[model samples]
Target chain A: MPDTAPPAPSGLAGPPVNLRNPVLAGVLAFLIPGLGHWYQGRRFKAVLYAVCILGCFFGGLSIGHGQVVYFHWQNPENRTYAYLCQFWTGLPALPALWQAKYRDPAVFEDNRLDRELNAVLTATLRGVEGELRGSIQIPPGNPGFGRGFSAPFEGQLRTPSGSVPVKGQLSALMLDPQVGAGSRRRIRGYFDGAPTSDNSGPLVGPIEGSVPRPLWDWYGAPLADTDGSPNSQLNQAHRALGSRFELGVVYTMIAGLLNVLAIFDALYGPAYGDEEVGPLGPTPGPNPTPGSPPSPGTAPATSTPVSPGGSA
Target chain B: MFPATLLFPLLAAPVWAWAGPTRTWYAIPLIISISLVYSASRHEGPPLILRRALRLMLTIGGFMLALLLLLLLLSRGT
Candidate 1:
């Protein structure tokens, strides 16, 4: 050990490194795993830390179809506690915070059309409305809930009693999409078809249908309806992944948490009293490995108590 | 630029198609990561970190397997 230990902010790594700035390394690591180590000239540690942390983070994202990391702190039903851990992954998870603040995801599953029906003047159809034995065809266009074709329709309307041939005109108007609680837009139209009477319209009651919500409204947004809101994206996320949603959350969370250790490693040298391997390595004492044998004196410098701050 | 979700609306669906029953296997990467990071915290050199990480990985994997076996034995035929 040199009888003198010169100190500067950048020379914090003792067993002595020239420019291993610890504070900057910590901040960089917090922003992106391994960045601090990279800044500290620990290239190998940097690569491994980045690989491990980012792999887990992105892997969880892929598992959940990129729906896992979202921040909703104020919403009682959507308070994302896992985000406390997920936040440590740094930049990748930061977007969730932006989304929570700026994006609304203002759409929900309502009378959205499962499929588009083309305009038809008189089309044959079978199994009309499940119980109806005959087919029904209405006008061509995307119909919302409670709305059907304004044009004439021809099909057998099946009843519990028996199959009955029915002919009528379907008329309905689109309802204004007033989102529930001002949070989500529900698109729907109501229509009651005229049955039997060509001039009068449907014999049956009204039906409601809707156009599907845009995908952008739900992706990466918090979806769980834990707040008793029926219009959450959680339903869709749950439908797609089933139980894997939680697993994805766990994976990303662990990755975030793991980066914390890397941050600490960057701020302070090895947690155990292991000497940093470098040209100015001090004599092995103070903290010795339990099983490893001490090295013979190829060379040894005078000893001084090591501080994490590299203070002598 | 438009978000990818808007471009590929259907991407909401899970694309990996991992087997539903075998999610337990997904822990391998997590365990390895945990081992590597934890070991790195305790050692300064890359060689020391790698060697320590390998032992930690084995230890964690063994513990999980033993726990799984215990649960399997306890829950048999239930």
Candidate 2:
């Protein structure tokens, strides 16, 4: 009797808001990173969708991490790892394609926003691949965790036949993100009196800032030589300098972990039409061109039909 | 240009390999930088920041390689 039929359901009711068919939404998401939500009138998810895919890639460049070095090697294991890393690390370039498919109907058919998004996504993917192949051979010491100047640097050079004891100071420029910006320090050796220096050219000895701590500083005693060559020690040092091999393994693992987080962000994060919850959609801004159709080109506003609960 | 960039490294590779890893390690980064610049610059529609970055990396890497090469050559000549 009290007109309980919802006042005739004004405005266009979207295909019955099927909250049950997650597969439909998932497929939609798979197709165009943010469409399933956009289809459901969720806007913010769309933005997050674009950024995570694009941002990680840009971030990869800043740290010099995404180098691609797969060369179809003969070793099956090596080839398999190469393929794994490529797919594992290079999978962020698919969402925009998803968005391109379910572009907001209100926006102009040739959506400019979609075009820009595509450009950035493509650039980031290629950039990451280029970065992965390019390796930055750091001298020694762990960078980022703490100052690297303190790490032990020890290796024996190799000769044509045997090896010789080689000694050289391993030093790194402490990328201090504090006072004395761009400062560098050097650790001469791990013995009793290891000479140290900081930014201001050369100091007397043993830099005052953060005492150098040696992690694995060791020297192998000279062994018998057969063909005897000075270059041998250096070669042996090169071979022994596989300390960073573990570091590489660690880095690869970290990259893989980040890839997982990125994937999750791509899936359930805020998308278009996210802000329009609560009593009414975002304090109705001065509706720029109220009567005019919402930008026929821009993806539907990221915030549309407020969240289902009272708090939109 | 890339072929030239790569040629020098390839030419010097055996020499560096025979010489030692310190030299080779330095040389590899240089070669990589050169290849990256050559490759990144070739990508169409990149922003200025990206273009400059590629060139900057190339310059740093090339300079390092050249310096190392020069040092090696000098060491060899000496």
Candidate 3:
């Protein structure tokens, strides 16, 4: 008679593995916008990766927009919150996104030939050239040191330099967040000619600040100084967005990555099993024919059998 | 521009002979607030005497206050 001793169960070598419910790979990802894909074993898209790539590329922009508005209203200053808003605003506002993405400080260049040229061109259009002069009075308790002012046109008041005409009233300012007051200050000396405190009001002095020499000097001042040419002031606001573009691109890319990861997770992660191989592995099937009696040389199944002895 | 109130005609003339930025801003909000209150009162048809008078008073009062605030802003701004 052939020996019929049951083969030893290979507990360590269980059936081939395969996962289901791929969506649950990363619970946080689904819970959090782009985290589930990351949980399902995808990297790079743990945070921003999902938002930029997946959200933007996959018609998720509407979702991104709503999310952005919700988050922006919730936390206006947070970079993450700001990006959430910006991402919805889309590519035209890329510069804004770049800043929010990286939290970088924008530094305006010392010269803005483009703005100067534009102003010059526009002023010439209205017959007599228009000039704007203003001084800011920053209170002592404000964040920076002494306040400064901007000269009208800064010598570029004669020619058009850019595509857009320069309208002085609309020119932007490089506002110091710490100062609740004006950024520019006019030197209003005492009746004795001794410099007293700068007055807090609109442009009051002669248009002499339009000369190039003073304009150049004003622009040359440090980024924080209130003393700047009109071009510099506008450029400062632009720079604030300019320096941030690269950073925003990075963050958007990260969001995209997370979005992709989430997609992948939703498509592939497992539903059940601990210490089990990911769903991508091979799965096992019955031995071709069901209910066939075990052969004399057949091995017992590796999985522990459910005991009939547990409380009924 | 429609029916000029006592203060409206004076406020509108300097900048446009019809309006000022500060005054306009104030007027818009006040008008909106009046319309809102009128709707909120849940009346079926036109407002009665007391309601109509109250609406006009709120409209005028709110507009004046908003104008005052706007003037203050302009005085202190560029």
Candidate 4:
């Protein structure tokens, strides 16, 4: 390529000036908010952008307990629109892609398991109660007390005659036949029909529709598997945060959208004209000629101030 | 000095503490941030930017409040 450098100034000269490369600055800004401004030596603006934008983003992450950031395209119904704004925060938002790809499928699978468990629990309780009332004497040591059963069963049951072999893995306590409660009420309470004094002992009480751990894991928790059950450290953090999850998501999304402005500023100096004179100084006010003294008494030609935020 | 365990939980505290009826206050900081950034991008001098940002914040806050009130009335069908 030919050396196409412009000829040196022919007259008295001033200090040498450095020009900003908009493309490089814009790319840097996109990679990290405010980096482009820092590249252009706008240190103040760079710091401002970095602090405000990143603070909002990280603040949101802490609020959501890291659950608000995932993306889900496979199941469009599950996709959170907040991510659309969050994607503008550049690299910080990329983990959402990893979360969507690896984590969401497992959550969906757990949801399926929860639905199946719910059905089995409901059916098993219905069958047991119906058969017990209908005079079907389950043999003394039958595997399912003479009822054909498929689901895994655990826990003991006591009847009027003797200990009935009541087997079901859903509840952690034995069903007391002498409690004289309706079968529907027992099923609602998941067979923890009566309160036992020993807290360390099995949870045999009329809990207010408390679903099993696996079912609660599916219906209530967003990051149930990663948190390792409801009582795990991560879930405890989530419970503590409560309803502020939405606020966290908003903070992150606002941070990302704000970065879009920084990116634009880096690409094309400020939306308004630069404060300092540059190689291509503020678009030559109304008069085109450079260095020409204004003619006597004509008002100085003023440059048009750009609109708020230099939106264009 | 705070305990080490307290520090982490404090840092990780949700945006709003005891966020019941006062939950609406959470939007104030966000609106201020939005105003500051928007106004800063449009002006050069620090004084000018700060002044514009404050004005913008008030304008946006008032608009949101008006909208909220309008919605509340509409919801009541009054």
Compute the TM-score of each model's chain A versus the native chain A and list the values.
0.52, 0.24, 0.23, 0.44
Model 2's alpha-carbon lDDT is 0.30
Pitting candidate 2 against candidate 4, the one with the higher DockQ is 4
Docking class of 2: incorrect
Please write out the lDDT profile of model 3 over residues A235-257, one tens digit for every residue.
34335445333333333444434
Q: Rate the local accuracy (lDDT) of all candidates.
A: 0.59, 0.30, 0.31, 0.49
**Native-to-model Cα distance after best TM-score fit, residue A248 in candidate 2, in Å:** 11
Q: Distance (Å) between predicted and true CA of A172, model 4?
A: 12
TM-score: which candidate is best?
1
| iRMSD computed for candidate 3 | 26.0
Q: What is the C-alpha lDDT profile of model 1 across A1-312, one tens digit per residue? A: 231323212112224332256677788999999998887777888899999999999899888777888876766756889999999988888867765677544322332323333322222222145332222333334455564335344555555656555654445534222222112232222223434533533455443333222334434455546555544556666776887788899999999999998887777555543444444453333332234332221123212334434444
- What DockQ, on C-alphas, does every prediction get? 0.34, 0.01, 0.01, 0.19
Candidate 3 lDDT score at position A185: 20
lDDT digits (tens) for residues B3-50 of candidate 3: 434455445455443244432342343243333322212111122323
Q: What is the TM-score of each candidate against the true structure?
A: 0.57, 0.21, 0.21, 0.48
User: lDDT tens digits, residues A1-312, model 2?
Assistant: 131212111112111122223445445554444454455444443443334333433333222222221122333433324224323334342222222233343222111111111000000111111100011122322344333433232333233544333222333324221111011111121211111222222111222222211211101011112234544322333244444423333333333333433233233221111122223322322223223333111212322433333222
